[model samples]
Target: MKHFFIEELLPKAGGSVYRLTRMAARRALELSEGRPSLMRKPSSDKVTTIALEEIAEGRIVYNKEASSVSSKDSTSPRAVLMRGNLASSQEKASVS
Candidate 1:
């Protein structure tokens, strides 16, 4: 399997690790499902390696429309609290 440095691929993924992983993971999923690779010569047979290669080669990119939405500070206290509350509520509802 080929290994890639985060610094090398950051720009290709719009400089966001979140976006990079999102794009790579989706592409990897497609490849694992037997979708033909877009590369003329893929770097590796492993799905993840092929996905990163595609990303580095500009075949895959972060979602432009979602940039604004995903750029939000979802790690803020309020966001975490909201998620925690939602999860607890979901658990409570499911237990009944």
Candidate 2:
């Protein structure tokens, strides 16, 4: 088994122990759900271990940006797609 110290992992996770723990937890959950690993010899690495290694190696980046999508941007691809679907549904309703 590979043993790692908290000191070694904190630097890779932007020096935040909370961030490191959060990332490792989420990644481990994904791994448990059969997500493919970013490491070699994945068969031998436990999910939590692989998660830690990925964070330590900088393979996973934290998304600091806001998650919400603004609908004010009508030209956005999501907006355009939604508009297209609405138009089609309205057309079908009129035809019926």
Whose TM-score is greatest here?
Answer: 1
Deviation from native of the Cα of residue 81 in model 2, angstroms:
25
TM-score of 1: 0.62
Residue 57's lDDT in candidate 2: 65
Model 2 agreement with the true structure over 1-96: per-residue lDDT tens digits: 777799988875567787777667777777787767766665346889887777666666553343221123334433211112446789999999
Q: What are the runs in model 1 whose C-alpha is more than 4 Å off?
A: 66-96
Candidate 1 per-residue lDDT, tens place, 1-96, comes to 677889989987678897677767766776787777777788678889988887776666554544421112334322111112446789999999
lDDT of 2 at 21: 76
As for candidate 2, its clashing pairs are none
RMSD of each: 10.5, 13.2
Model number with the top lDDT: 1
**lDDT for model 2:** 0.61
What's the TM-score of every candidate structure? 0.62, 0.58
